[model samples]
Target: MPSFDIVSEITMHEVRNAVENANRVLSTRYDFRGWKPL
Candidate 1:
């Protein structure tokens, strides 16, 4: 038998920051116009 602890975490602030940056880039870039991340 084996037992272990699994833990996971997400930093929402960083995630939001990244998404905002990406969105800004996508919006400004001509090639990425109308593209959105799922």
Candidate 2:
């Protein structure tokens, strides 16, 4: 039998940072100037 711990291998901090960065960029971009995602 084999087992794996996939959840332990993922970095949530990095994922959150990337998402925040993307949101910042999108918010400042001309096309999405006033767009906000909630």
Candidate 3:
């Protein structure tokens, strides 16, 4: 038999990293320039 357990700390860490990478890409892209926050 096998058992599994999920601890959200690891999941959250990965999510945070993904968001950071996405933000970095969006900020550096030329098309994103002049986009104002609402």
lDDT of each: 0.88, 0.85, 0.82
Please list the Cα RMSD from the true structure of every candidate, rounded to 1 decimal place: 4.0, 3.5, 3.4
Which 10 consecutive residues of model 2 have the lowest summed lDDT?
4-13
Q: What TM-score, computed on C-alpha atoms, does each candidate reach?
A: 0.56, 0.60, 0.61
Please write out the lDDT profile of model 2 over residues 1-38, one tens digit for every residue.
Answer: 99987655658999999999998889789998877678
The parts of candidate 2 lying over 4 Å away from their true place are: 1-9
Clashing pairs in 3: none
Pairs that collide, model 1 = none
Tens digits of lDDT, candidate 1, 1-38: 99999998889998999989988888999998888667
Clashes of each: 0, 0, 0
For this target, which candidate reaches the highest lDDT against the unseen true structure? 1
Q: Between prediction 2 and prediction 3, which has the larger lDDT?
A: 2
Please say which candidate is ahead in lDDT: 1 or 2: 1
lDDT of 3 by residue, 4-25 (tens): 9987555888989998998788
Task: Name the TM-score of candidate 3.
Answer: 0.61
Off by over 4 Å in 3: 1-10, 36-38
**Candidates by TM-score, descending order:** 3, 2, 1
The parts of candidate 1 lying over 4 Å away from their true place are: 1-9, 36-38
